[model samples]
Target: MLSRNVYPQTRPGKWSVLLLLAVFSLLIVFALIVQSGQPFNLDTLFDNGWAAVVSILAIAAAFGAFIVGLYTIFRNHERSAAVFFTVSIGGLVALFVLMQLFL
Candidate 1:
């Protein structure tokens, strides 16, 4: 017979993980569109409306993941690598937005 571990390992919050994945997938799509062998710049984004839309979605997902990650860590008490990754990714997205607005 197999024995179960006495102490159960905590997993990341589900919603947070989902949001983090959404952020990454959107970013990947946006990158693919932007890096399709032409000069990449903000103007290139404007040229491809799909890329701009994807960027917005990625930003939104990143913010959502960050908030959900914090909630999971504090309220749900989830202790997992994925939650930390969610927070870091979200923080980067927030920082980028802030820099664009101010700088």
Candidate 2:
């Protein structure tokens, strides 16, 4: 009888998952703030230094999450579906955001 070896599935690195969650939470908060209709717009965001800073930071965080996710998948042999989903979607979202902000 021949038996196949089964290796344990590796989990994603802690930072990658945490950063991804943080980015999503920030997106939800921004959506809520905008939906509240309190005169918030890109112009207002730029005019208010703090808002602009926060938005930029969020974008940075998104990119950070994408990089970390890729690192884990390639270097650490991550097997989680969630990590794959996060990396693919997060990377695209980050690029879209950069284009919207600067172009």
Indicate the residue-level lDDT of 8 in model 2: 20
* Pairs clashing within candidate 1: none
For model 2, residues 12-73, the per-residue Cα lDDT tens digits are: 45676677788877777666655665654456577655556666767777788788889888
Runs of candidate 2 exceeding 4 Å displacement: 1-12, 32-44, 97-103
RMSD (CA, Å), candidate 1 to true, equals: 5.5
At residue 85, give the lDDT of candidate 2: 68
lDDT of each: 0.77, 0.70
- The TM-score of candidate 1 is 0.73
Give the TM-score of each candidate.
0.73, 0.68
- Our tally of clashes for model 2 stands at 0
